[model samples]
Target: MITVPDESGIVPFLRAGPPPDRTRHEGWKRWQDQRDKFIPAPRLSLEEYAALSPRRRALHDLHRTATHVNLGLLETPMSAKVTKLMRGRLRNNALNFEPGTRDGLMVSGGGYLGKTETACDAAATFEALWRDLHRQLLPGPIPGTRDLFVPVAYCRTPVRATPKGLCAAILDFYAAPHPKTLHGMVRQVADSIRVHHTTALLLDDVTRLRLHREDDQDTLDLIRELMDLNVTLVLIGVDIPNSGLLRGGRPDPRTGQWILPPVKPGQTFNPGAATQTERRFDLVDLDPFDYDSPKGIKAWLDHLAGIEDRLRLLQARPGMLTEGAMPEYLFRRTGGIVGLLRRLIEDGCTEAIDSQAEELTVDLLAGIPIRLGNLADRDPTAGEIPEIPEDIAVPAPAPRPRRKGRNTVFDDRGERPAADA
Candidate 1:
């Protein structure tokens, strides 16, 4: 057993180098640009991208981080259907609950949705779980797990997307400061974390791998390798159509298009209660916050206000030249898609500061009239648009079909209906 001392001088076995370098924004940018080609056109710029709060910024950074694995991902809803599926999987009897191979969870959503934040939070939660489990196994308490939530957005090490590269990346993850390459060191760290039952791995922006049509094998190999280490991997990314991340193939008569394998027990969809592999890693579908929903809107506003407050505090203090309010306004506009919101806000804020505004406000926000502005244009223009009232119930407009040509209903033959006198 390697004798490794943690920050608090508690030496048992595991030695982790300084958490991944948090100074690598350029690496992230390159990943983002590479990913943008495979996915739909992104709506956020790099400057707008930078203006997010550290938490929100990290979420967007994941796309850049995972550019090699799961690209061309789409946004799907975390509907009742998904939750029901999750509950079913969790309650299955055949689940092994083994230390090494329980079903893990994946956190995914729209490009701008908060997948990174969720992943980071899950990492923190898993570390806490590891500590709690360790306490059960050992007589004493474990330090360092108390604050497992390390912000990795600025980590400079270029993330490796290929199978071999990923292995190297994992090695680099622990090797920056030591004499041996990081991979050799990571095995020791992995052994330590594994022995302590702290092997859950959180990977954000996994969609980056979609660029390579053949790279899905790399992903599978990596996942299988982690599973061997008793590591529960949580991958975050934009949602794809089916449970499987990679799409495209021959059609299955049942679903028309070739149905990708569902995220089943041990990779089997809908594990039977008696099935032995039931308790493997799980797949979760995270939906975009229903920005139009009352609760969602409120949460978004609060996010905006909080960011604004952060910027205001920063500007008030020394050592902070430019306060950031772009993210706050982004919540106001994009409805709280942490990534896009940050992008819009950052761009707008920079423009505002460039023009020399003492403070940030709605006027400064106008600069980033992104797609949200287009959506807002469709909002009912009936009443004086007051601050969206709390607990207010705005009746949804009755559905109406758009008329062709003459600006009215169409005829039975698919032609525009003639106007009445």
Candidate 2:
């Protein structure tokens, strides 16, 4: 007979350690390096700007508008729904613990729909809010704690979603060791969550959990247990055949009882009745950006202009424009997906710079490979051109006059002085 480890071993694993302070951690540096390419809008005073070198100042003006575009997702209807569900969870969980509450948010979308990014952004916002609240309530650092409190925890679902694997993922997030058995792992995870005061958990790529039908109930049960502990779970993944949580369980005709697919004898399954976990989630679908609508085109152009505005503030040049038919062409090519649009713009810009072109042209964008969706045969101009928004429309720049002589000098103030003729 196999002897289980005593509860003491499990108890030690559950003891809450200090929350992670990412700012001082090595991972913080990795994050900074990854995002270093995108220049954020500077909040420094004029005096601070005056102190930087020309190169540094130039770099400061070079903004990655893609981030701004990503941020714009918050304005979408899907995001509003997600926000409402999350707020409800926070409010309800704070007042009283509701077991198996309808607190989970399911974000489903196609590839390149920015589902993962949106979920991550939402998680970050929640975590920041939690940190601020913690600081306000407990100004003094807790002795022996790395962080005051962790309001949110974000992790990707494991490739093989076993009960032990899921528990190990949570443990790894908190830098804790896990016991070999599923029962011990669950206890440790639940305890760690309580000790850290984690109110919300975001799991990306949840589709990975459905690989094995036998483990489906185990995964769902784990989620239910987390919910019972008052942890609001946000599940993000690409579109799946059925609801990510409630797939594969069917009703038995003879017994009139719901039965999940058979699992190995020792494997864990949901002890509760079937269809119980289905009610715990609020599903939110993220559709691709609508490039055909006036509002959609306006949003796309405004995102680019927002980045240009930052550069203009620092006397730097603009990149993309809104004044011509180029917007319509871009909309048709990218089919309104944010990821494709970003890639198209970035590749076009690189090509233009390499070819010494001052502005992005239709010819430049046409050269980039279309690897995303099947748009090879689709004509960008086949559909009706979306009417440009009145406020967003600007008259195209007047063509520069040709110089009469080779030696004529074009002044900084736009005056073209004649040569010594």
Candidate 3:
């Protein structure tokens, strides 16, 4: 007969941990929980880990399951620069106390380039600072209002989002009840946004809204109106510029940046609002690491070094990923897409542990295919090394150009440079 594990026991092995609720990730409770509770597993030297008893090692390995290979969020050149731009906009709008309507931010990029995470990181940082400044209390608290002091709100656009559905997503972020009607939900959302002191509202996957659809137009209109609720909108999407989000929009003559027109006069419901003409917004791009440039290659190698340092593998050594052909091999394997790289690395680490190799090698990681990211838009590399060293060295200018020349690499005998047979 099989013995059942104890449901209630003082021993840790006999107890249980609740399964993570991934569905609620867009909500505040889940976001805060993940943000506050995600602790990377401690790294132990191979010797120290090997000396541990089997039980202890098993427990430690279990702990590692959560974050052993996790590099968390990384700061690339593109992301670092773009994040500064977005955060500055968020700050400018958030600090304006006498604001009629604050300028918003739009971050667009290909899928899995950490666009949403970068925006969310900035927003979270802003919220943390804002709350600390307000002594963690409601900012300018209104009497008889019991809404939570939500400094930042985050949600995703529904695949078939209408104005009502969009409003519902916003309301759902706060777990606030709402009526079934579009107008009611919008009113509740506007009121809740102001009462709860939400300074930044992040709507990710905004490109999901089809501009051709009549409902999406209404939804976009509602988005502009929400800006009037004393909040800065943080819009994130995949390729927003190409998504026709800027319908009838034109690039600035001097700046050459797409200037999205403000809410149409017919779309306005509240005529008492300020002379709403230009809804100030800026669009930033987050692209994958480019391996063709020296700066990009340096950044990519540094990124690898960072990941190497964070790894908890027993046999991992310095320059394991950054030295020799490993850097270029990895770049080719994952095509320099951070998300795909992350998946390949994490999966490779898991395989290493299971296989008792305890180290990531090109041969080991090569077979683990890069199966992440949205295939509809981005094509991830299949984790194959076509050439170990694919000309990563920067070619210096020759002292003199030659009409015909051939590289003379040494033969297997370790002799001088040789010509063809």
Candidate 4:
């Protein structure tokens, strides 16, 4: 005879348990430390700066100061927007996740504008929050369960951006084997995501997806399927219009050609037939740094000061280099692009060190092998600095031809007559 358990007898097991002791849990402690690792860099004391080696000191000050500015205040608005969208999706999933309801974020920017880094930072924050929420709701591992529940899944978009490839990538993130067929892979990915209880998915470099391909529609549909499982999607890519991720028409399978949206003369091309999945994304553009802005100028000054402080400890003072026409010169040369500015500074530092200059000067900077172009007239009143010395011209490297397919070896003799055949 078997005993049957009553509701009253099982009440303790079914009731919500007390919160787990976070300090005692090694996993939670590790996660807490990881979250705290991204704290803003604090200013170093004089003695501390003096103790670092010359190379370490230079590289540290350069990266820490520059990255702090670019990734901190300048990126706050975009970061907040991403966070709001992600949190809203999470809330919707908890409350009422309707079918065909997919809220996504699209981060677009020019090349080298730090869009990838910004998206990654946002993803890290979301993962941390997800971990905290899981701990609160579920407390700890379930009895007889060997796998850990991962709420956030972040991955780069597949290079060959087909529907099958994307599904396989997601399955790979969950450490699940996928079937060879496209439909099979999709089913496996959906099952893995559900089993893992994933709440969000971040795909970076989505520009790799080809436009006007039949598979593109399949990829979009797969994304909708993922969203139906309550996963918030975030895509990061370059600001290219109509790359199939957004603002593009699908290929017509019958004709095997693109079915582009028609537009009248003088009217902008707008696709009125976008599916709910394509229209659900909220687009955010990350602009390059404005060197003319007061805030931007201050950021430059802070970076230079950081470099100077570190250099001073090595007995090579970069006095007054951060002032006068130097900032204007840097802005004109690099056009306020963060990546270009970093390269200019790194190369300039190397030149200064090689020349044994006690103080970095305007002349020393002009000599660095930097490719200068037409400068933007963002600030007319900033006034002209001395023309970059004519002799400082470093010829830009020749552009490489874009690779299309397999490598080809050309004959030395051009176009040999086919008459011999």
Candidate 5:
């Protein structure tokens, strides 16, 4: 429904739109916004839609655009793996009430590989369950205290990250006070986590940390100390393993796995000492979708199918994206990157809705430019459909059951106990 008119007509609607993209979305308030936003475009019967007035229909069209564009990040096998591993670690840490340092999780991947979204998704889910179990309240709050039981804190490793800046970022999440001294700030961080009953700490964009800098090394040390705060520290960044984030710790010669000598809780490590974090974190790399093997091909197809099912185009065919060369065409265009595929589909859907094409075609996608990240080769033949392996056949997902309209015309209510509503 359109908003009521003011002194002017519906011009107010046109005046407002989403804010600047540069605004950080990792804050608690902004993160909650992302978590709670889900607006499904209405699937109206042709007759029902035709009955709307011109203004109402136009407003509906505006709604359709908003819904399609922000359909939200779809779950893929990649996000599932991250969520499972992360939640498992968080649960494990929560159960360990002993004094030893809790282990953490690191999600490493290329840019636009849905690393932050996956980590955040898992964190948010864990927070919801935690809140429910605690009845949405932290136990034993001082009377009349306005404390928020945050459960999860998300922060980006500063662009020019340092130990103090890192501490500030965590404190900033809770609007906790910052101290002038690095030691004081670190103390504030631990105290804040305890006060808020935070269970998971997500430090994203860790690739920005440079091991060569002394302040960066101190920051790494601070991160390990934060782990002892009894929260599962989840480090998310682009190409973390290669980013020198796991430096200082040496890999075992025989086992060929990262290892470090354990440090006692509350003890600071020598700047040159082996990183206490390397052995404690289960570092998982999130790879982009693969199209080379049978299993890989099936995963790619399944991903496309998931997107296809969510499409609200009135004229969309059942297999608009899953069937024929479209999937492969999309794969080539996106290079199996989830972010790129989403952009391609969202843009295509927008075009389809406005043009009345009602379905995605190769030509429509061809006209749509996908901004493959800075690294792509920009190959001309990318738009050309390549043949996928013939053997692996992926079955389409079962169509979801539609909800039957209610019979509101029935006269009997509670008076007729035997009749269905």
Candidate 6:
């Protein structure tokens, strides 16, 4: 009975006094105070703060502290897709309509893509929305009803790539005081969903499900259980191939598999669809952001500026590019991928901080880390170089002054900078 991290416990401690463990209570109080202080900070809009319940707020903080890996740009197709999916769930009041499909989800993309952040963002948003809706549902001070949003019954990373271990891990999330068997865990999750009427089982890294040698029968069984029980499953990692092998179809256990989930009739993994099958395993592919389009480029840059503004750790200010300013420098640098642009800016910011600089200029950004070159090589649009830049300083000399003689004069290299020297 391994104790899963008590993410939802903070709210309870804040609401009512915990058991008489003076030291634990003191620590919990301290945590609550700190949480409260930062939550209503001036930066957060009143609406945003109002929407979050204490428990959801605490969970947000925990998730932020643990998962805050600069989520560069939110305008990318991948980012937009994530937003769309979450929005759909909210629109449908999926959390409110329980005995909901617990079939789970899978987010796949290339490397350095923002898969983790996508998951965290979705989790945070879902929790926030759930709390808001729950508050609305219970207008009065309802007795015997919990104020908190859906609790994370179990959230484990890299679900062990093996079925038995993954099942055990999920069961363990219930802990000792609660049930430990799979069926029991399912029941517990179901009850939690009804209790708060909002609960989710987040398997953050399900890319390992496609292990070649490892029989997926057990894995499929567990997924079936989750679906039957109405738990939301979330899978995040790189793009799985056609056969569903995530790690390039490698048979090595180290490089996991990514097979297509078993689906019911007329159901597909398309993110654009309104409804899906009974075991609705939604597929959200986070395609690299398209910085190529004018609109996409502006959105990407604005998002970066916004992030920088939020995280004051940036020592050098990005010059003159106002919140809405779309600089060709940024647009070109990002190669249209918001994630890459963010990496470039953050890396540049870190260097500025180290050097104690005042501004991150085009000069500084020149050396900043970029994958655009590689991206370009992979680009179907990269045509042959028509003209070179004069800024390179290796002057492609204009037609040199011809000698008085019409005869061509060769230089020592036997090649001509001019037809006649």
Provide the TM-score for each candidate, comma-separated: 0.45, 0.63, 0.79, 0.58, 0.76, 0.52
User: Ten-residue segment with the worst summed lDDT in candidate 5?
Assistant: 377-386
Off by over 4 Å in 6: 1-78, 90-104, 132-154, 171-198, 215-217, 240-278, 307-343, 365-421
Model 1: residue 295 alpha-carbon error in angstroms: 3.5
Tens-digit lDDT track of model 2 for 1-421: 1111132323211214543333222342233234323333444445665676765444433332222332233345555565665666554665565455435667776656677666655566555666666788878577886763556666766655777777776777777778877777787877787887878777666666554476755775666556555677777776643544545555446643333333333443333322244334556777655766778667777755553453223223454555556666666676666566666665655455345463466666666764444544222321112222222233354588897776536545654567733
lDDT of 4 at 318: 52
**Decoy 5 TM-score against native:** 0.76
How many steric overlaps are in each model, in order?
Answer: 29, 1, 0, 0, 0, 9
> What ranking of all candidate models by lDDT puts the best one first?
3, 5, 2, 4, 6, 1
Which candidate has the top score in lDDT? 3
What order do you get sorting by TM-score, best first? 3, 5, 2, 4, 6, 1
- Residue-level lDDT of model 1, residues 290-405, one tens digit each, is 56667765555555544443332112232222224433334445544544555554555455444545244455556445433333421122111112212322234347777766
> Please, what are the lDDT tens digits per residue for candidate 3 over residues 163-263?
88888878877778888776677778888787777888998888887788899888887777777888888888877878878777776777655556678
lDDT of 2: 0.55
Q: Write the per-residue lDDT of candidate 4 for residues 1-421, one digit (tens) a residue.
A: 0121122323211213543222122333343344333333334555765676776555445444333332332343434565565566555654454554456567776555566555655555656676778789887887997546766666666655677788776776676887987767766776776787776677766776665666655565555455545567777676634454555544446643233332223321112223333325556676554666788677667655654554322234454547667766666666655556655665665565455463456677777756434445111221111122234333343488897886557536666589966
Error of 6 at 325 (Å): 14
Candidate 6: how large is its RMSD?
Answer: 16.3
TM-score of model 2 relative to the true fold? 0.63
Residue 302 local lDDT, model 6: 65
User: Which numbered prediction scores highest in TM-score against the true structure?
Assistant: 3
> Root-mean-square deviation of each candidate, in angstroms?
19.4, 15.2, 9.7, 24.0, 14.4, 16.3
